[model samples]
Target: MKIELSGDTFYPVGALENFLPQIGRVVELGDLPIAVFRTSDGRIFAALNQNPHPKGGPLAEGIVSGHYLYDPLYDWKIDLTTGLVQAPDTGRVTMFPVKVEEGQVFIAAAVLQQA
Candidate 1:
């Protein structure tokens, strides 16, 4: 379900603690599935759960290293910050804006619409 909060129209997914550093969590925004992550440096990111590779895989289940998410299904390294597939591959993953307010995590509804 989609909930609007402000012009930013962020939908509450969960609390900051819902995500662990170097881990990714799968969350839904409307009908769109997203991979929400928290890096080891206390940074948060959200992206489409599906990998762009022809033989797709679940990105949320991938390994997180720094700002890169290594797709375990095929070992494709993806840049979490930009959603761009790193060297040797030529593809990109869609990314969404994330916000932490009042200890809660929210994703922009606008991004959900785009997805």
Candidate 2:
């Protein structure tokens, strides 16, 4: 789920050690479910845990490779940075801003409303 918090400051959800490289971790921000990722190359990204496909797959369980996540449910490739579904699929997931401060990971709680 996506949630919108009224704050400009990023909220710290967990430490860097809490994230597994090349794996996605689900973090709850209020009522929102966010998928946090730590790439093998040391890049961090945050996206909505809900898959945009009709199956309603959990994106956090998807396989992480480079900047893309391969959804295990439907084998759909999703861009971690943009949350855009790679070719063959035509949908986009919500991408959140992630910040690493002093070894702690923080995600912007702002969520854009879809039309």
Candidate 3:
């Protein structure tokens, strides 16, 4: 599982840590905006929070599937782990590396260099 550190800042992308127990939330890492999802199965994904094909508000933009979200606007699946734009969409979004320290989540700025 990918452990994405996100709360209000960006961090480095050094592989990843373990997953956490969460219901998912929005995180701000530097200039990179992201959404962190902690699956019920303990799987974590950090996908680019932007919806190239947005359906509406941040809460109503895409469909969650495992560690990826299916962009509702273009029928594409975005990988939160690598921020990889999969089929239905060609362009990829930004993905930042994250980790949780203590009880708060942290983002690595190095991972957002390309974002």
Reference-based TM-score of each model: 0.88, 0.89, 0.57
Compared with the true structure, what per-residue lDDT tens digits does model 1 show for residues 14-110? 9999899998899988887889989999889998788889987789999999999999888899998888999998798877789899999998866
lDDT of 2 at 28: 94
TM-score of 2: 0.89
lDDT of 2 by residue, 1-115 (tens): 4444345568899999999999999999767788999999988998878999987978999999999999999899998888899998878888788889899999887544444
Give the per-residue Cα lDDT of candidate 3 at 68.
71
Query: Model 2 scores what on Cα lDDT?
Result: 0.86
Model 3 lDDT per residue over 15-70, tens place: 22333334446655565556676655655566556654434334225666676766
TM-score winner between 1 and 2, please give it.
2
Please give the CA lDDT of all the candidate structures.
Answer: 0.84, 0.86, 0.55
RMSD of each: 4.2, 2.4, 7.4
